[model samples]
Target: MKNLAESVNIEAAEIMKIFQWKGTTDQLTDEEKTHLKYEIADTLIYLFYMCDQLKIDPVDVMKAKLEYNKGRHWKKDKE
Candidate 1:
């Protein structure tokens, strides 16, 4: 699909392929790590493409989003 949103979902699905039926995905296995890395790069490529298409600065938007997230109450690790 030419839709950027669709492209994002497709790329995300590709990334998720490595994690399918896998447990403790937070700790990716060596093999899965490699595959995930490539998929993540693919996703980022599409993301950058979308940014260019929209005439938006990805870095600036990311920084602003991070700053907005900083004010959320989601901090503190489970102890």
Candidate 2:
């Protein structure tokens, strides 16, 4: 779980680069874009490995969560 969480954190940091740039991902350099791609892949790899160890189907769980979320009422933040 720790490894999976850490990988997600690293991916989040990479994603934040887009917001930090004050523009879209296209504003990032080619190398930065590739690095973000790798970070996302690393997070997915960790998630799948953890799910495999627990004998869980990642896709099934994700589908279930999506269904659950569909029933949820989210309050939009005041702008």
The best candidate by TM-score is 1
Off by over 4 Å in 1: 25-27, 75-79
> Candidate 2, residues 31-77: lDDT per residue as tens digits?
77887788778778877888987899999999999999988777863
Cα displacement (Å) at residue 20, model 1: 1.6
**TM-score of each candidate?**
0.78, 0.68
Put down candidate 1 lDDT per residue, 1-79, tens digits, no spaces. Answer: 2787788888899988888877783677898888888889988888998999989999999999999997777647433
Q: List residue ranges in candidate 2 displaced over 4 A.
A: 1-26, 77-79
- For candidate 2, the lDDT comes to 0.77
